[model samples]
Target: MPDRHVTRSGDDYAEALSQLLPQGQAWPRDEGSTLMRVVRGLSQIWGVVEASASKLLEVESDPRITLDLLPDWERNWGLPDPYYQEPLTIGDRQKALVQRMTIEGAQSREFFIGVAAQIGYTITITEYRPFMVGLDRCGDNRVYGDGTNLMYSDTFVRGWLPVYDPQGNPVALDEISEWPNYGLGPDTNRHYWTVHVGTSRLTWFRCGGGGGQTGVDPHLRIGLATDLECLLNRWKPAHTQIIFDYSGLTNGGSMAGTP
Candidate 1:
């Protein structure tokens, strides 16, 4: 067991006094005695220093539970960026701080996948490239910039968000809601890419879950991964166009996110 740092009390002092001297009859060590009263008074004063030292030594050390030193840490790291709006929770602040401190800067697809995992989503990235002749397979349905056989994610407005059930209760669906890969086009279109996430977030309601009826858990539904999309937009390269998509169907099939 860990040691208690409360320091010596009157009982401890009295016991030590008896041990240090020859077997004593005068030192009855009773609480009512004058000698015992003096010992108790001294223990209180001594306890103040011990308690202070104990608290000092225990100063919040881990960032996971770090409360007292959070402000100092945030200021030093130049955090609370405009990318994230206010009314943020302490857990959110801590996560951003730790991410800022440890994440490696990269523009790779795998890197973005790792970033999604940090925010509680498992996702896949699709990179587009301009089509070519001879080098490309015949009848491969490559884009010629005419818009045929090519699809792109225009997520200018995400209308598929499940903010309410059919009954209009405030709720989010629990589903895959993943989008299909935005087909590539012209050379400039190569900058357009897509991320397909595998899960959606939903808060448990007292009445049950997000399903409008039957009280079904909807564990296999494909909903939205809003946070993953937001974070990716904030970090994607200046030249790249990111398309966030999730399956609209519960069968794990892709949805045509474009108009």
Candidate 2:
């Protein structure tokens, strides 16, 4: 037998309901057909319910919260205001110094090395002034601490010189005043070792001229070695990364789900 097809419309549903009821009676008749009227009423009710649900979601997800709404004591409960937090500790200050120094490039390397020395650590020098080992006769004839003639007056100096005894054994120089031409030599062979003791004091050493002339040995100097080792142990450079989330909660409540 061939399959029979049925149309699916509001009238078809009404007719089907009518057939289910007693033969003489029909579904409650009304204007614009009972089925359409019921469907329209349900749609209107659903619209009101949907609007109410959307309003509830809006209330829950609201993100407007200000400190003025709460008492002073209550404001400290969650996230404390950055301005009102405790002052940074020494470690924090040191870390900040390292971060800033790293950004300043070569000029700040001495400062970094000083800090590392204090902490009992050392860093390899990748770049430095080529004529750092010589006198005031490199690229610019003017030398550091030579009044106002130097081009890069801000740069630090590190040089070495040898001391020779009139006899045979090497000996330290009695006084710096003995050498009038010290630091004024045009050749790289006449420089002397100088150790900086803190920012203000510099101690110059005139070693016995015997072995190959070289840079100052930081470890051999008692004062410099002790100070630098102390600093290295005190402020070892292990920096920690920090991240902050600026997105705050809604009216002091838990974070709300998406609407």
Count of steric clashes across candidates, in order: 14, 11
Q: Provide TM-scores for the models.
A: 0.51, 0.16
Runs in model 1 deviating more than 4 A are 1-59, 85-89, 137-184, 202-227, 248-259
For model 1, how does the per-residue alpha-carbon lDDT over 108-137 read when each residue is reduced to its tens digit?
988898997775566766565665443333
What value does the lDDT take at residue 136 in candidate 1? Answer: 38
Q: Once superposed on the true structure, which residue ranges of model 2 sit more than 4 Å away at CA?
A: 1-180, 183-186, 190-193, 198-259
For each candidate, what is the lDDT? 0.52, 0.31
Worst 10 residues of 1 by lDDT: 203-212
lDDT of candidate 2 over 158-203, digit per residue (tens): 3333322211113333311112133333443232222222221112
Relative to the true structure, candidate 1 reaches a TM of: 0.51
Model 2 residue 183 lDDT score = 39
Worst 10 residues of 2 by lDDT: 249-258
Which candidate comes out best when scored by TM-score?
A: 1
